[model samples]
Target chain A: MGKSIESILKKYDNCSRDSLISLLQEIQENEGFLSEEAIVKTGKKLKIPTSKIYGVATFYNQFRFEPTGKYHVMVCRGTACHVLGSLTVLQELEKVLKIKAGQTTRDGLFSIEVVACMGACGLAPVININGSFYANVTAESIKEIIESYRKKEE
Target chain B: MSIQIEVNGKKLEAFEGETILTALKRNGIRVPTLCHMNDFIPSGACRLCVVEIVGNPRLVSSCSFPVSDGMKILTNSPRVIESRKTIIELLLSNHPDDCLYCIRNNNCELQSLAKEYHVIERRIHGNKNSFKLDHSSTSIVRDPEKCILCGRCVRVCEETIGVSAIEYINRGSKTLIGTTMQKGLNTSSCVNCGQCIMVCPTGALTEKNQTHMVQDALQQKDKTLVVQYAPSISVSIAEEFGMAPGTDINGLLNAALRKMGFKYVFDTTFGADLTIMEEASELIQRITEGKTLPMFTSCCPAWVKYIEEFAPDFIDNLSTCKSPQQMTGAVIKSYFAEQSNLKPEDIISVSIMPCTAKKFEMQRETMGRNGVKDVDIAITTRELIELIHLHGIDMKTIQPEITDSPMGVRSSAGKIFGATGGVMEAALRTAYKKITGEELVDFKINAVRGFEGRKEAKIKINDDLEVGVAVISGLGNVRALLDEIRNGKNDVHFIEVMTCPGGCVAGGGQRIGVDRSFIEARTKSLYDIDDRETIKVSHKNPEIIELYDNYFGHPLSHKSHELLHTCYMERDVLL
Candidate 1:
């Protein structure tokens, strides 16, 4: 947010507004997600409106507004997962976290998001935490799986 | 180059690269279009303007398809008509069946298209999307269920006004136009310009109705309801009653307001006069002191907010003079209060503006005194028409009367404030006199007129001094102008920026379809008033001169500063 990001902003100073997406990607790569300050500074450097930048950013699922929590939870909502009753598993996680999908927990220890597909249909009704995929997840097993992530955060 | 094209068995002449829709329209051939805005590039999103080509297997969108030599197009063939009917039926599949209670019932584009297509019954029924109504923004109210996703609002907000406050989120069936991160519009860099409302085909976006609040105040016995209307409102409000465009109904409006139970109906045009005085003084002070060059006019709330949010570095360059509406409201709450021995809270000040941003402007923290807001409510000209009809008062039957006394009198300069270059024209009229003890040669400054995105003029005040002024109505134009100024390409000392294109005369709250002709008519009406009045300068207004001589003492005086001036602060665009 200080001198560290100013140099990154300067790199894109010569870039045109069409380069907004790549610039946002570079910033998001450096930072976990697009912070409020990063977006504003990128807008200034690129000479693009922040609203326009946000619009372009929101178009891609890769760009997240909030930083991922200590442990990121992804529930598969693809056809395979849905057939295997992943909706109940996702619901259980939402109920326990007291936050819906696309929201971070109040403590910032965990975040939940619904992914369209993880591309592993064989391992149906899956939940992934911190890049580790957990297969055959059930409504009841969701508690222990989330507990493991919370324990890791601790 | 002219190109020959056949439309429905008739040969038509069209420009070489012209769109099929444009060609058909020029020849008086009708094509039903919802997403197609007159000034904007073709979106081809509506799929309602599909035309059958001679060789093409599928129907092509006439709006996006170009005219080629020897191209045969059937505008209303049975197949094309069938496709359009299906498009209309699909659009109505998810649209709410509440047109009777909708704000844009009769004026709704989709409803009219439905009427034309004879979509009496819903042929294709689907899942109705349940979206939370966004009343978070002070000015605009967004109802997602009513939105047809035509992308007209998105295009106008992004491409025209340079305020891309709302965008298309998600994809395919799940898509809906929303602010970044799906947050409420209040959190976004929405200047509350209401330009989106102007472009929206449905009642999806509308000005937050304050007419009920105004109506409630009118009923209250103890509360003194004082109403003021912007100069633009008088010229455009006539459109609601089927009158000719650019009609001056100020006198009739004053009489109607009195009939509707307004104890005092003062013209905000007088406030525009006061604005010219303070704004001219501010401009003179800036040039003389060389502090903030290219001082932007702060009369437009949306433009003021644009500076505050996007261009905070140039916030100091904004004129400190309160807008005419706010100035009039401040005067009503202060001088009017003192003269009438009425408490500030006891009096309710409402203004009928040709702007939706005025609704948001009334609620600004800086626009208040002693915890009492200057303007209680700001309703658009459309709302005023509704209130007039609700009260069962006809303007034609009423006697033409002048605006109420002490705050009523305004000059021709103030009248032009509704038009695009009117502010700069009025400011120069007075700024010329203030700089060198001489009036401008002629009141009409031709250089700073018309619908060009940006108008610039260099006025040689005398041998030593010259005032370089520029006026732009659209924020998109202002962005380019600002960049030019930053690059040292433009040495303009003063700039007047209005958020909505064509200034307040074609403001977001003016009417539904804001095409070029209506704007010209409205701008001409303002100039006509400016030309008709004997007092062409703000400083020459006898009431304003008396106001200074008695109460304020002078422009930029301590008393004047307290009520007629304000400041700006930086704002966050996103969370």
Candidate 2:
């Protein structure tokens, strides 16, 4: 993890501070979360303050400052998703997980977020858990998908 | 000869060798398009009119691509729909989604096409590129982010006006339409005609609005909001209220303005007559003194702005007289203020004009000779309709009423100021009498009147005095005339130039979504107004002559020149 952060910092060493968010996003996509060393090194390399870097990391919903759960659920709140009761499906998942959106259970098995329109207009309520699409979801379908993920985690 | 073209598996007979797009349109098949103009050659940059042609292997741009014999065109096929959807998706990806907030949200062709194509989301993940807004010019704005890079505006500027001021700068994703050398429109050779704004499909090019300022004035109880209407506005503004083109709604317009909470509703024609008096006197003075020969009319703001930017050498030739609209503002602030017993600063003067350039013209430093900006805010004819609608004034229900006394009334010479060659005709009507001291037999100068690009006439001002007059409409025609003058090929004693194609009636800030029939109707209505007016000649306008002699001494007098005329400034800022 330390070596990976060092390589990410090296890749974005010459990038300007204005493009730090885009660079950090690219780094987070590979490393999953921004480590302390990665944040400090990014600040040093981009000539940005460490506090400012950490502030930006926490500001955007896409940036994960800490370690994420084993299963990452992104429920689309796009125009299509909202029209097809995606909010209700999200509520069901939160109730079952004993946590809210963008939170994981005490066991650290799940994390979720609502994203913008994902270009699936006809296929509404598209939920992606661990990079797999589950379209036209209801409360029951969401429960089933979360149960399968929980079983796999176990 | 008929050409067989198959659309959606149905065979239709089209004109032999006509564009596939035109053929489809003729057969009641509507394919989305943005850059296709009936007047110009097809550019086919929009890619909305893409049709899947069998045996051709690839999608063809129907606008530019001609219909071959036995052309199998599959429009709205699954492949074609998918291709169109992809194009729309790409457009939507970078386009700003603030539809409700946008000025042209409902009127925009792009928004309508997006809704028709069912483009709900952007699948591609690309960073949104930000660009700065350009509001340097008073007439038009350049919002780069809203620009789709369809090249319609660029083509219209080059093909229609022949002013290649705006062009595509840079390349790839960073490409933008701008003036050469990235100069502000004021510094560039842009004529401020606003043909580019008229052709733009999106909210990329728009008129600078002073609606908020008018709204503020309306709310102020202490300030009296006095509004004046330009001659061209009455002819075209009816279209905004859904009335038939060329519907003479001057009476209805007066009633509507009164209903909109205006204290005094005046006519700009009165000021136009005043303009004729001053301009004709200036021309005669220049000719007699042999200084600044071939004096140009300074009525059109776009023409004035064009001269200020491109041809600074011809500044001396421009008549040192304010436009009728500006003259009305100055008169209202000073002359009308004293007559009505009101403070010039307290009386808020607003002008309704069929011009976007008038908004910029009012802001010029020289326009504040009346101790304040002559015109506080200038709203386009379309914006006046918007205000009327906002105030719940139904134009159809409003009873026809005549304009108020004095400034509200105007002569036939003032009424004709809306059309091409109007200024030259108006000036000649007065200048001939001033030179020969006799009323001419022919009231209408047939030579200077018409839709021709450039017109010239040699009228005998009595037996000894023969004055050569040239009338140029549209900025492109003006450029040619100026080139001829520079090359010493063209020599005329008097000249008139209107930046718009058909003068103020077809101005940039006129009503949108109009057909050719509507334009004809509006033009006929304008002429009808001129024919019906009792006072035909500018010299016979009793109110204007009374105002000049009783208040300001006479035309071309030191006070009249100081208050009603202004010099041009050589602008260097880029648009």
Candidate 3:
């Protein structure tokens, strides 16, 4: 284990209902995803019902219940990206990866997620493979993008 | 202080901090709302209660809007009605169109509202939710496709029961009132108290339909079907038959069950007397040995489950006696089986209770650990009504008959087990006799009998031994009392807990949409039955006395312990 949840939780001594959002955010940052164990630990420390903590956590798009794959692909659905048919791009990526939105490939190589307002709206029809952005992407170029990653890994 | 407000062109006196809906209803004006439930904080998620306020340009929800001095409000103006109609139409566009086959059917609030607004044509045919029904819970079912995102069930589960087993998983339109990780309710820490089903305005939540199983059982020729109904059913079942709320119909029910092909239609009250016999002895043993100081009554399955889930430390403190329903089942299988010349497996024991948790309770491994199942099936008061109607048995014209011998006769103390604090009252009546070798001068213990959340009494068991006792109804009220004892701030000797607010009288499986007055009426009928009875205490019941002399030998004997008492397990709350 990288670090026990107890060690991470000790950084912030404020275990109140008011600290729920921030506590969840910090735990997610440390663990890369909000695990069930983390959620339960946070619930106990904050003295809040886990259901209520879930209510607060699920309201925001920032939280992820599952960890990301080794190679993450984020499809931008910003206003400009939507105007440029980024939804088709997401569908093409999902079809090729054999996974839906917010899912990782079974082999643990690739994952796909849809994000709103990805900040690079100028680069419409965007699919950021890992940290590298592939902008103005077409459905024809989708296989080439994954093949490039697979070849690099080899 | 009263604030004057104009509602529907009429002047109304609004209490200072009351909502606009309250003020309007006080003035005989009605506004439709689905998410709002009495005794819970108003959830303004449903836009049906939107009303036109003169100063504000937008339509505001009357349920959460506070009444101010000289506020002009119109509940059913053209614009407001149009807004409400649009909201219902939008909700209809997404809701499943299976109202005919829906469990709620004509009783559905959404259906009634749609009829009121004439939402015949779809304005917005949006993508409908296709959430699979959660049939994992033994007592309750969750159908997210029919859910209107009201959050009443979520609130009641969290606020009243103190078990937040379900919650909002996703946000906005994609939101689902479900367990964490979208797991089945069985995996979650749901105690199977069907209060969620009671508050749900739609058919999205309901009891797991055991009616079909019951019908099949009735049709089966091989099994000897032994049926028993809880004490509360006498006062409760009449309401389902379109009779008055508090009419005691035990005699009629006994006759009807027999006519419906039940071989033995027994009263569960006899088991309640057996519970008192064992529970009182256990309390005396614990008091003498000073092991588990304050014994929590285990008569309410939901309360027992609550302790098992949240407060596992106090599991030993809980009285090991099975609930009267399960106790009756055990006796039927073990004791009654040998007497009736039938094997335990041949007898199909069915319990009719005013609790949804009883369904889950019967299925516990502990209940069936003694080789024979205590109860084969447990159905709510609602299911009993369904069976009665299904058989077309006219309850009114039916000739009243007495219950069978041996497992039939019960004292009034046992009869009162339906209401809150009834178990404590019955136990106190017997415990007093056990402590001091004399029958109580006054049989009635009024201190532990009521609709209040918590009640306390100090019994004088002679000058040297004064015992403190408390009775709690709701699980929310239990935390404070338990905390007191845990912190060593309270010296209470015995505690009584009935999970649903007013015990099994207002149990999760009782009739939905019950008012406070109806609960009081049912509770009064129980007390009246106790007063009218020749024998008021559990120990004094002749059948129970004969049972001890014949079968178990004495109270808390090895056989009584094997048949009556049970153990609790610590459950994972987060799972």
Top TM-score prediction, candidate number: 3
Better of 1 and 2 by lDDT: 1
Could you give the candidate ranking by lDDT, starting with the highest? 1, 3, 2
Output the TM-score of candidate 3.
Answer: 0.97
Candidate 3 off by > 4 Å: A150-154
In candidate 1, how many Å is residue B188 off?
A: 1.5
**Candidates sorted by DockQ, best first:** 3, 1, 2
Q: What digit string (tens of lDDT, one per residue) describes model 2 on residues B422-458?
A: 8888788888888888876777887987778789999
lDDT of 1 by residue, B1-575 (tens): 99899988988899988899999989998898989988788989989989999999999999999999999998889998888999889999988889999999899999998999888997899789888898889999999889999999889888888878888876677678887667788998888989889888899999999888988899899999899999888888777667888888888999999999999999898999999999999998988887779889999999999888877888888999999999999999988898999999999898999889998888999999889999998999789888999999977788899888788898989998888888999999998898888898788899988888889889888898888989997888888888787788656889998887788988987778656787788889889888788999999998899888879999999999998999889987662
Model 3: per-residue Cα lDDT over B228-338, one tens digit each? 999898998677777888889999999999998999988999999999989998999999997877888898888888888788999999998888888899889977888
User: For candidate 3 chain B, which ten residues in a row score worst on lDDT?
Assistant: B364-373
DockQ of 1: 0.37
Q: Which residues of candidate 1, in runs, are more than 4 Å off? A: A1-38, A66-71, A77-100, A105-110, A114-119, A125-154
Alpha carbon lDDT at B451, candidate 3: 78
Q: What share of the true interface contacts does each candidate keep?
A: 0.35, 0.00, 0.57
Among all windows of 10 consecutive residues in model 2 chain B, the one with the lowest summed lDDT is B180-189
Candidate 2 vs candidate 3: the TM-score winner is 3
